[model samples]
Target: MDLIHRRSNSSSTGRSNTYDQLRSSPYADVIYDTTSGGEYLMKLQIGTPPVEFEALIDTGSSVIWTQCLPCLNCYDQRNPIFDPSKSSTYQDLRCNNKADHSCVYDLVYGDQSYSIGSFATETVTIKSTSGQSYVMPETIIGCSHNSSMLGRSFSGMVGLNLGRSSLVSQMGKHMQGAISYCFSPEGTSKIHFGSNAIVSGEGTVSTTMFMKKENHVFYYLNLDRLDAVSVEETRIETLGTPFHAVDGNIIIDSGTTFTYLPASYYSLVREAVEKVVTAERVTYQDDDSLCYKTDTMDIFPVITMHFSGGADLVLGKNNTYMDYGEGAICLIIICGPAAPNFGEAIFGNIAQNNFLVGYDLSSRLVSFKPTDCGVTQDIPIDDNSISAASLFQFNIKFVLFVFVLSLIRL
Candidate 1:
């Protein structure tokens, strides 16, 4: 489960958009979204009057930005663009303004997608799972004037990372530096912030997070190895090599669709999985998927991802295989082409289903507990109507097991 990947935080101009989060009152909420299997979305209400904006919750990217008014060739969006003129609380940051505004930010993605905008601060609100409206004022955000590829599908993106500009990092002392999310099999998921984000129980497995100075925004994990188990077991070790180390070679991102592994290592994993399954391997001319025509996935082996600190993620048939329609089921794990100077694995959201994954930045630990995410888990509210001591609870658990991780950067 040891992961290794190169950092892609630089822009075309060689300038890094290092946005610092403004210290403010922190509050937790559960944002709900029903997205395609590719990515998770969040319903957020920003500004003073609180206009609704649907954002793609991305852990890989930092800086929560949205399209602003006076567009300079903006994308085709379905939602109404955010107009700072309408909000009295909105303030545009100027490069020369020393009072509060610091500097303008320019962002560029690894895929060459870019956004240029001025730094701004405004009030952001979220509807908590407790049915209470919580607001965080003076929140730092990017009011983009020029953005690429971010059109009507989403108004903007909410950054949830360890970076200074990330939503979690900006929460500061208001939140206990913890965040968790539970994704259902039906593609409905909810994100929890603050103290309630902690995952505890017999099934919860905790692992130490590895952080590197160069890549501070992304959350890294110590992936030990991967195991393919059917009648016989096939093992692929990811650590103890110079390529894999404590600095963290693997990234767990919620926005990515499939788990990516390096080509060479993935070949070994695919061969092992193919040997254990009796279904015929089918290849499409236009698609890059390892698929088979099987009525059920039980014929395939269960994959276990073993990580450092004894954290094991046991992936069942539902978590490992996906239906591609027309009686074809494809494996969710993908083998990516080898990149020079980078050999890291990416554990995408597809592989994280049916589990309550919690990230505690203060303790530098990531905890995972298997649960029926299809069932809703509500947070306890401190209200007189409901006694805090006698709050409702559920009995869900996880099996501590591990699987192999493919080392792929992109």
Candidate 2:
């Protein structure tokens, strides 16, 4: 997932208020909240001072990058610099693309304010309340020169979400088995770093949207009000495109800002949205995301994507449209920032806000359900650490299969 939606990084406007529910959970300790909120406060060490500010929890962005003191392009910062010099365990792995790193990535957001120096290998630690600390390895991070966007004045981002170079994937190498986590927005959000032991919870989570094909990533789609809107919304008014894509895989990233679609499909969607929204209202257009204006009446009728099993997902007015400004919204929308083959679509935090995504590292599964809040929770599936059986109907299906097979054989 590339840049989902960027507003050409202007110098600065009015400072916005940031809110984050950051807490520790037994399953995943680093479940930090990166909502529209600016930043959060956390003690680097048990005795260390707690620093908080705005941070973009990007599902699209894999690396957890942050601004430092020496950055020339650094933007409005409110907190003290993270003095890497002070920490005894601090060491810049210095593994850049120049060295034995995978891909040399030097990216600048559309704003061109913050330029990131991509590098692999870094040391990460948590300042535990009991004065104890644990370190995780194989995590990649970003060094930012500048930071100025919706949120402001922040040290850096705490990214352990899913993506190609995410800390989860990198740490998985050393951790051995898997990493299970749930982000509790109610001051209970914590990262369950390094182990599946922490992901235990009561209740069985279910869904057919989870796939363990490649590295097991979470994926879900709800077209707002597919049920109500489909009455006159689209030809195929449904939820997810039935039968999972055998062609291209999908990833549910919390860091990304917007969604991406194939060129042809995007065009069709634009046309569908255009049918309801006139051209005059939704005129602004660009590369990353489609910009549109909405009138009082055009509050988002409906946008449905027909899926298998005849199950139609009905996205409400909110999920159906994007908010651009006051009394107006994006009519026909398309969010594809740095998307590959135009096929790789990203369901960024804004969209993910609608669902509670549970990631089971040990089982290699991601489950999603209707959630009003942005914080993804562990759906009370069964008394199991990982929501495996709940995500995939495999366990239930297998039991029935065995029973029927036994009956037939008998």
Candidate 3:
């Protein structure tokens, strides 16, 4: 799948600072401004005649949903709401003969945004880079009738997580439980599934991927230590507390914006950063994030995250810091909970920019390889493929979503 960045209408060429760009942008929202909430969007065609629509690509979520016609309550969207009556292939998934046997789903996000709808199946079509259209019949989807707080740029969301109802799971043997995506800092990117998703080349590092019985949606990886040029290597267990390293510690999530570490470990990392950075210190009043007033991001030190099995991910300045407008830049890594009750630690997408990340669920391994994501790459299709079982082309659009700790199904 090929991905492209959706550009804002506002002119950003002559802006002296990020602050000016943020202020001039029309899509700026209260949550984190326009730039911070950016996410990748993909196009999907549903039903017999095919109603094409753009959807946000979320790795944290599982269900694929789009607002439907006769919406009792819904947020404004760029595309027309999907009308099931017009599609010949659309069919509601009825669990039983009961009057209320409609398979309904209620998805609530961390920011209190919600989507309520009936589960259904439809013929979905996605075009590959080779101009080949891959069709999947009877694909599970959520036809949302009520929704709130969704971005106006996209008509729906395409979830790429490891859930039973997800597109990957529904594809079953066709996808072979494999998926991979490469996110560029700007311009176009690509994602692969099944045999094409394999990441085995030079400079590629593989780490063990484990899942919790309670939550299978997230992809968890183990962190051995962290290293900076000037500071000593900091290990997770040495933080004056009992840390669980065997059960898989941090989550590598594409939906999240910032990386999160335990408070105590985060403090150590912050202190190490403070020692290396020579720029004038500043404070961001909005989130109190670690900020520095600097003209260039080059002053920031590179961070090396050592994961289990010799996977050392080297994070550069662009991966570790975010422009907080003005002359200030803030670290994208934030503190989560502390000690005994340590909450979920997340490895966000900012640090994943320019990397070809692959998840092979069958092998129970996740691999990473640094690459120039901005360049266009051909979608590698299997030559022996007889039918269009699983293939999707996605245009990457940056949209942000605040994840809730729990996904509530009502």
Candidate 4:
């Protein structure tokens, strides 16, 4: 399973708005690649005949969706729009009366991108590198007839969060509530589910994971302290005026490009790094990133993040900073909006590079292990691991009833 990164093609104005929206909302559903700060895409097949397409893998959203045919208004995509009418296994889940029974969904992103479509069920298939195929039937999906402001690289999104409609939750007991992924700086990466997702070996550390009552679409972790090696150790609670150690203080998101801290705390981190590095300070007018005129990241100090349960993640220059232009490197961590408006911090994917990160939802734990993601061993799968009879049985009528009922309640 190789993940594809999409580069940014938007103008400077659009890029600025994307950054501002991400900083203000912790739950933005934008897909990020390394260049454009978007997300990783996975190849999958939808419908009975199997229409293969690449979809954005997001941890901040729920509901699997793709642009469908007869598009009222849609953005250009690399692949052709999916035609539900041509699929033999597609089911509309129409009500008895059939006059106005279509289940419609309107999903809006923080950057004002949106998808509007009807809810339906179809067969989904995922093929592993070893040529083993995992077929899931009656998978709920949104057939987006109207959409806007989406990139052309990927056709749709695959939600991997803790929400009920997420792919992980819909898989039920088969996946055992587990998932793992390894991200490389460049080239392809891998993501696994079920038993193959377990992370265990030397240098592996586990930490507690929290799920908010109001928001279950994000993975939360607590940051106890941070130490700029050979510089200074600052407790998170003591850095900001009224900051305190709370469970799930920071969210670990794979769709975001940079790590974000509160404005007050980020100022302290900036000052500490300025004193340690000898590189000439440069202003990055594009965004609120700290840039330095240096040829190499060797001048930057190693940053250690001490999380709850004694999980100390040691980040090198590659994980802490990135190349901005010809002769300048900028810190990947930036200052987010001020407190009250945006209080939660973000642990973006840049810091997770070169590490195998595993999440065990049943155990409520997340594990991290340092590994060269670019050249990692592949997990072998048994040909008979999953059978057609073992697939979860779901009632389409019942699902439509509940979905329509929820809309009525709202």
Candidate 5:
């Protein structure tokens, strides 16, 4: 099989200051994120009596975990658990040692935990507009015995491995084209699989190539023009950084709802942002991230993000800070675990709101442009890459570099 290769900018230290995480996905009728602000959903089935439920489509994870009947520790579950004993088609994919990412394991979520198992082959059915039935075979699905509110209401996760294994792929065995992701943040959405799989309305958008490696996704930013005037002390620079070549490894994460930067770039951003803001009244939420009181910040620094295809992408206030249940977002600076390491940033959901995002795996490219939602921005349109006539199926490959190690932890 032939593949598209991407280049990277190197540093004198030779240490890779990049963050890329990969997960695997496989299921039937499994539509990845296909809604605006991503309110995508999928149909799910439980065992024995065969319980069917509608679930959210998640690609930021690997295990296709779900909640099932006999759920020992399920709590405040808004939905019914799957009755595995009643389902005649349920089969287990012993989670002990399996490469299909079907090995069962125990997972712990905030204030809740559970046992997870896998299914190697299962029947997944999806419907088209005319009620057309499309099914997936031998799908790897995860079952959560000890469940919680987070697992019960949702159907299951669809991991997006590097061009392989996904709920969309399993269903694609019976569909028309590649899967695309369309997400927005209300924590409620649907994920579509196959042709016209991932869709949104507005048609005015552009395209560019993405930088990927191994099983990870890397993205590019035209840093040379990241700022209109002086951002901080030094001129925003990416003269020599990983994935800085005309083309290299850059990643966009649906799961990681924040922007991450390499150590050096992180430092520069912090230093520069600090120079503009005063030390007093500066709030410290976490060690890795930071922001000053918006009122105290100096003249709003114009951050100019240069995209590959000559697109000028910009971030609204929400992109820099999260509400954290508060009414306002942090400004002047946002923090990731990297604090100030390299010179790269990982784009997260808050930053991607309403923007038309396109990732073309077939051509190894990713692109983004502005959008003016009824309440979001005043901008005109939000469209992205690919063509309906050509059937664009860009296989997204994720490569997880390290645990909280080199990545900018939000």
Candidate 6:
């Protein structure tokens, strides 16, 4: 199998420094700011009676888990915690189970947040665009206990990575290995699977996805250049050097709110942006964001990201700039700590709004189609080739659950 490997330094914790908590605080009541596009959640049903949960759709990490009953130190969530005892189809996985590996798993997040729980498999269900419900039994899941801060609006999280146990991979065979999501910064979004996941036709552009064999959880893309240029063809240089040949230099993260660039690249981009904006730039001592006093964004120049495979993404003034409120506007791009080997550039969800992003695992390619996601019509699912028997047949009484150790405590 072709896998996309994730490279992490052998730091004492084996996690990235970007998530290190600079301030000391209690983990239970941590609140994350969402004004900058923090996360997106989707609805799903699991187990016998089919309990519904609003799960955070995360592409950066692999591990599908939810807070369950008998919670020991779980966070206060908007939705009721899932109770396994109520689900007739729920079953626990034992360490000695033959068909299954170990029933226990430990997880730790980049933020030093952790969860411990049991890993089990159960029936998973999702609604189609037609409002019809589809069920896949014997699906892998984690019923977390002693969980900490998670997105307050989220009941749990759905893993959409390349790992074998991820929701995408678990549904790949039946869904033709297709998945797509269209995010709206102001509201919620829908996640499509199976035949409904295809994003083709006009306004669609394709790009090659780089995958390594070792770690396949993160999506890597080749970013050629990020530049701001005048219509006159005059090259405007950013902070650092012009450009470097960096292959698979960045990861597209839907879970994160802000886009992060290396310090040098960020300085260059910010300088170029400041030159054209007529609004007065100001900095807030309480926050590190660079803000301006203006309601008009059209006066700003267009920023274009040239990607591999000749796909150029042109950012609109509105997409690149955001309203910081109180008559203040701020640039969404942030300067991240530099990483050796260009290991830290992240294209976050803020920059991906109003676009239909699709991942075709079979073809090993990712596609971006420009559309007004807030009003885009749901694509019809074509399940003609799937046998009817397979749709309703329940495989071996599958059951598992785990406490997620690494989750976004929003």
Best by TM-score: 3
Note each model's CA RMSD in angstroms. Answer: 15.4, 15.7, 17.3, 17.5, 18.0, 17.3
**CA lDDT, every prediction?**
0.69, 0.43, 0.71, 0.71, 0.45, 0.65
If scored against the real structure, what TM-score would every candidate get? 0.78, 0.56, 0.79, 0.78, 0.60, 0.75
lDDT of 6 by residue, 180-254 (tens): 888776554567765556678887888777765544567887665443222213343332443343446567777
lDDT of 5 by residue, 32-66 (tens): 23332233445665343445665544443445556
Q: Which lDDT tens digits does candidate 2 get at residues 296-371?
A: 4454456543333343444445554665565346632354345532346554444433444555545554444454
Q: Can you tell me which runs of candidate 4 are displaced by over 4 Å?
A: 1-38, 93-99, 128-132, 149-152, 225-243, 338-343, 381-410
TM-score of 4: 0.78
How would the candidate models be sorted by lDDT, starting from the highest? 4, 3, 1, 6, 5, 2
Candidate 5 or 2, higher lDDT: 5
Q: In model 1, where is the ten-residue run with the lowest total lDDT?
A: 394-403
lDDT of 3 by residue, 82-170 (tens): 99999999999997755789899998865567899999999877654223345668999999999985455567777778887787777
Which scores higher on lDDT, 1 or 3?
Answer: 3
**Candidate 3: what lDDT?**
0.71
Cα lDDT of candidate 5 equals 0.45
